[model samples]
Target: MSGPVSSTPAALTAPPKSPKVAPAPPAPAAPTLRDSNNNNNNNNNNNNNVVIDGILSKLLGARQTADGSCARVQLTNRELLEVTRRAQQVFSEESMLLRVSPPLRVFGDLHGQFRDFLLLLDQTGLPPGTRFLFLGDYVDRGEQSLEVVTLLFALKVRFPTSVFLLRGNHEVQPVNRRYGFFQEVTSRYNLEIYARFGSAFAYMPVAAVVGEKIFCVHGGISPRLHNLDQIRDIPRPARVPKQGLLTDLLWADPHPAAENFTDNLERGGGVPGAFRFRPHMSRPPALYKRPRIFCRSTTTHYLLGA
Candidate 1:
């Protein structure tokens, strides 16, 4: 038999009260990229100096206004200094041998062709969209070394993972100090700024591998480089040296005409017996030989979106 029904009417029963959970504290907002350079601390203040996005709007605004005329980019001393520090922070976190992925655009030496870089940005997409591996030689030789390096550094700061910058022979102190980059920096600002650039260069990766299928560097393989780990072994925050594997990796060139040498000439310290690589070398270092290797002398190239 069914249980007996309540004697009272249904309206007389009290309703169950719902739990009073204070609406979850509105989900915390995402951290925004404030123009920390500016002292404006108000999170919601509509300050014009604020960097609304990851971009430096003031700087990017000037870039967006760039016409065909190759004009030198303008920046305040404070802005330049800030950029240096920010970029150094980004580069320092990277390894000596960058392990990158594929579908990249490679470039040769761009001796500060800022206008060309801009055009390439127009042709190919910018960072966060396209992955790029620059081979180095970003400074010296080009009239607008400051603009080029600054732009590259800024991009690296904004999109560290998407952008890869390898060290070239010219990135070293001796090469750039004389080949025009030093003079350019000193002319625009002072020796201090030039030295700051040196600090940034010290952290640039010398080599990169993409999808574990390709090897990339500013120059070519060094005799000392028996494996990818060997490249990672070299420490950074130092200038490229005069001898050894690191030197050869940045200095060695392909001899299209093999007739001039017997074997391994100046491969390391101009020593005849020192380790060397030959043009169209049938056998690469055993560890990394399986990957097809290609390199350029600069980060000044256009890259399409992957």
Candidate 2:
């Protein structure tokens, strides 16, 4: 306590002087993979080195025409058979009604127009990055029926989660035989190939849903399709079913004129199963078409296309 007591080593009693620490500098931004010459070369090499033996890979590597239309003959009979078998096997595993997510590119009635299909692929990106739900008629009435169907089957096999194929009227033997695909396959390959394709079609889904909003069908809706599960519960791997939800989905067309039509009698068209629905339709038609429907308490709905 005497002689100022050396101020009691002032630091010990006074608030301890905080260590003079310099604030940390801002951390550098995480490194990003900017495409560079070195990286591009590596990526190219990796892509080249990958060994794929499936039909999809064959289609990917197959030479397009000068106009980038139809694919040339890339598969042998053996390869085509194997691919068709794979298609039947894979499609069989899918539900009668598919449930795909948003971010899809849906198309209607390719009709064996391999060139247009190729053009579409060129315009829009293919999947798993960009998924697709083709609404049938994959074969018939085009120069490249085999090419189109084979490529589709290959795609479905290659990216099962990313590609979905629905059934159209032309998918059945009765239609395709009279149209073009049946004769085309028979003339080009054989009846065996044609038959195999029919098998694949039998397993195809009649419709698909996108999110909880959209319903995708090739033709139109059925009265029985009032509930979603009705579509889901229809047993698949059977021939285009005779006069039911399945038949209506494949054969019917939209009677857009009528909101809630109940066509009990045919007007001379007399097509036994040909029916229509006031409310019908798909997931994606690209970014071009989006359906905005307004529902009222009266059960009538209005679709405002934007």
Candidate 3:
């Protein structure tokens, strides 16, 4: 349900390095879904079918009510380019990646906790030369989503590489509309800036590889994702589009069982149509197929092998 949390293993320890501005490579082309033997089963076949049917049906119906609304509202390439340029200007290249000595700090689900976030920064001693990779969910569900975004934007501006921002489910469109982000933006800034920032989120990378060993993301792994490349091939939206691809990522819960190639059912005990996981667990024991492990500090449930 939450992002992956790991201990700072001694073997994986490395010092932070100064940020380097490598030339941004051309964005990878979006992957096309072809009929593959791996997904020949009724369940796997239904996944793509459900996505297409839902998107097409929604677009077809929305076309009648609004003329070119989707086209007009969608983020343009020019807008995205401008945001990136501004971001580059605000944050120095070196700020993007910091070389912390050993024992990295991992934080989860800030959910716009501005004061608490500040406390975390103070406690962790983040800014000067430490690397902090935030696993999404930065906004929403808190009173100060705007402050949280502003602070993060400032941090990114100050230390881009040191503070890595990954895309979270809440960062997408429909969820923002329902949650506090859109309203917070409109109230704090103007609708124009709100829309602009929304567009910028599309450019945010979905996953980050820390030290080439640990993988970090806002949400858990999906059935659609097998190898890391499969995740990379997913289209990055400039703005949250209808049918909620980004939303699915933010909300999708990961289970250890789903990671097993042998396990057919999803973490939520469903047929895996459109990758929906069940919302509730009948009992805590029935929830996970494996043993539950607890951290000495927090009692929240997490997969042992995960």
Model 2: residue 23 alpha-carbon error in angstroms? 61
Go through the candidates in order and give each one's C-alpha lDDT. Answer: 0.60, 0.61, 0.44
Better of 2 and 3 by lDDT: 2
**Highest TM-score scorer:** 1
TM-score of 2: 0.69
lDDT per residue (tens digit) for residues 158-270 in model 1:
55666778877777777788789988998889988888888888888888777775667776555566677877878878566546777766876655454322345644333
lDDT of 3 by residue, 1-306 (tens): 122233221211223323323421111121122222233337643453334323322221211112211111122334333433444343322222122222355466777665566545534443324556666777788866755655465445434445566666666666776678888767655677677667666666665544443444565434444344444455544343322434334445543343232232343312233243332222122113322331111112333342
On a 0 to 100 scale, what is the lDDT of residue 67 in model 1? 44
Candidate 2 lDDT, tens digit per residue, 119-145?
Answer: 566445455545678888888788778
- By TM-score, the better pick of 2 and 3 is 2
Structural similarity to truth (TM-score) of each candidate? 0.72, 0.69, 0.53
- What TM-score should be assigned to candidate 3? 0.53
- lDDT of model 2, residue 298: 12
User: Candidate 1, which segments miss by more than 4 Å at Cα?
Assistant: 1-68, 259-276, 286-289, 298-306
Q: Report clash pairs, candidate 2.
A: none
